[model samples]
Target: MRSALMLGSATLCAAISPAAFADDVLDNPFFKDSSTQVMARNFYLNRDFHNNGPNTQSYREEWAQGFIATFTSGFTPGTLGLGIDAIGLYGMKLDSSSDRIGTGLLPSSGRHTPGVDKAEDDYSRVAAAVKLKLSKTVLKYGEMTLNLPVYSTGDSRLLPETTEGFYLSSNEIDNLRIDVAHLTSLSTYAQSGHNAGGMTRADVYGATYNFTPALTGALYASDVEDLWKKKYAGLSWVKPIDDTQAFSADFRFYNQKSTGAERGGDIDSNSFSFKTAYSYGAHKLTLAYQAITGKGGYVFYTDGGNTNYLANYVQYAEFTREDERSWQARYDFNFAGLGVPGLNVFARYLRGDNITLANGSTGQTEWERDLEAAYTVQSGPLKDLTFRVRQATYRNSFSGDLDDVRFITQYPINL
Candidate 1:
């Protein structure tokens, strides 16, 4: 990994053409401004037991460290402005044993060692992107981190996920936005490697309309070849009840079907989610309900053929299950209003039952509880730095035993 980083750094330096170094070429100097920013992060995670099914136990503990660096340059002077962005990432195993390996936070290959030992040593990746802007729209190509509902990029591990693709976004209309994109390849958040054999081509389009100051709606459609095609529509509304209190509501519906090489026979699925929240003083309370109605279950893209789609959309409090129903209750408190800025706490509980497993099993029930605390530096050189800790416990009557604990800290700098 160190060698790869050195090689990539050298390539970047060599790729900068002398013609691109000229100064005072643009009429608007701000448009051609260039800057570089660096961000570093470290993560540690450990789990005492892993239960695949009822009475099953796989116990192990592990820890890892990761670092990420990024550079961005403004477009050169011209009618058609152009810019470039680069990202480099690396991860190393700080401590881990063979028996408790495979945390998905780092790359693990080959067979696991018997008894107890250490896992792999390290992994890394480097990516770059180019962009062009005109009027109120921008076109970008290369590695990207997508954040849309139907085709969001994953960032649950050492590094943010990246996709090799092209994307376009326009905000020409008043209070309206449009997004269109095409992805050709994908790399996991761990930056361990890229998924070359999996579904590589994907197309997505979405539009958002802000009807009023407090209300908005969006519609999106995505065609992911060799995977599932999905359509999503949602609405959000907020109403302030008082100076410091407000009520918010969100509703979303999803329709999905398989296509091309990813056609898992024939699948038809529909999912709906609704959330309502109320705020009072420094406390906020939220309740959500989600249900899936279809021939099978909710569909998601997973590189290792894992059926459980428990990613971003599925929160710690609730998960979208196949032919199942779930609900969650959550409470959060902000300390900023209480004279302690940049501190917050949250807790949630989720329950799901009546799940239909893929192997023709039925009558399954599961529940999970999550607790989290986070804080950020308010003023100083470390301002905007954030620290977070979370713990979760999951139990199911039929799905086996599951328990986990995670801790993370991050620093974000804007250039």
Candidate 2:
């Protein structure tokens, strides 16, 4: 069944593309229904290691500010509409020393080896894309931010990882969407050590189907050159029981194998995860389970700052290892039901066991607990401002224990 679904999705993706232009492309308008937005993000990260390792930094801290400005122009009024989009990205280091550097807030000084022992001053970059639209299908070229199931960009730090690629998206079919892309290079958002000049190539194809108003399913396949080939599929369903009660279920799976010359070493892995949640008024509860079964562990491409769509991808531990099983229990509360609007809190605990290591050990175990509180301004001059505080404690049989804390503030401006 999964193979059939994947084949169908691949066929659909191959069949979708943008329409060709009938007249000169210059006829399209430059700005018809254009919009622009700018966001200012302030980030602070701190980590203290309980057991100090000689090669690893015991204490890491960094403070940085980021500015992200995006401008998107509407398609020109014609049968073949043309548009342009541009982005300006900049990151400034506020405070960091040589001893306390590896926090990823600023670029490191090393060129060949990616490290954060010596921090750099600041870094900035720019990107632009040309887009052509015909009916409900659009074709884009140049730098882009991808959010596909198989290969997506990570934006958890001062700057988001961007890629140079060609993308095609079509929504002409009712309740179904198709996406295809070929990315040639990637720019790590980091200014210094790691993200300097490493660019890789990858290709992806995916399709998403909306079965109903509350049910959606997706299939995706990707190949990162000679590195790995990954196949992913997922289902999400939300059901409203009453006005203030609801239930939701999310399931995801990944199958990865080495391809071509196998540059990143051999990998043969399969991973699956599921999460179910129930919401009642301001209270919510969630339960999740995830496992990996293969000779190799679950791995994805990231330059130290990236995210995967797995169920157990927490702040500290991803819970992904060779022959591993994990479970999580979580709870959330919204202050609006308690007469305090715009406030929310959530906490979760995860445990993993039966981790198979390269040394042939199979009884390793680990756990992590995370708590976060966040609030957004309801109204007044500070409307739309958001503040968040996150804390996590992680312990494992293989590595040192860590206590992590993060404070973040974000404000958006439209012009």
Go through the candidates in order and give each one's C-alpha lDDT: 0.74, 0.84
Which residues of candidate 2, in runs, are more than 4 Å off? Answer: 1-30, 111-117, 192-199, 303-307
Positional deviation of residue 133's Cα in model 2 after best superposition, in angstroms: 0.4
Clashes of 2: 2
For residues 156-255, could you state the per-residue lDDT of candidate 2 as single tens digits?
Answer: 7788777778999999999999999998877776752223434367888999999999999999998887778889999999999999999999999999
Query: What is candidate 1's lDDT per residue for 1-415, written digit by digit as tens?
Result: 9999999988887776444554335434434476655555667776555446454336655677777777777776667778888888888888777667766676655644424334678888888889998877889999866777677766666677777789999999999999999888777644456763265788989999999999999998888877778888889999999898999999888888877775544568888888899999899999988888886667664422221222214323336667888888899999999899999999988888888878878778888888889998999999988888888787887644556777777776666
TM-score, one value per model: 0.86, 0.89
Give per-residue lDDT, candidate 1, residue 327. Answer: 85
Worst 10 residues of 2 by lDDT: 17-26
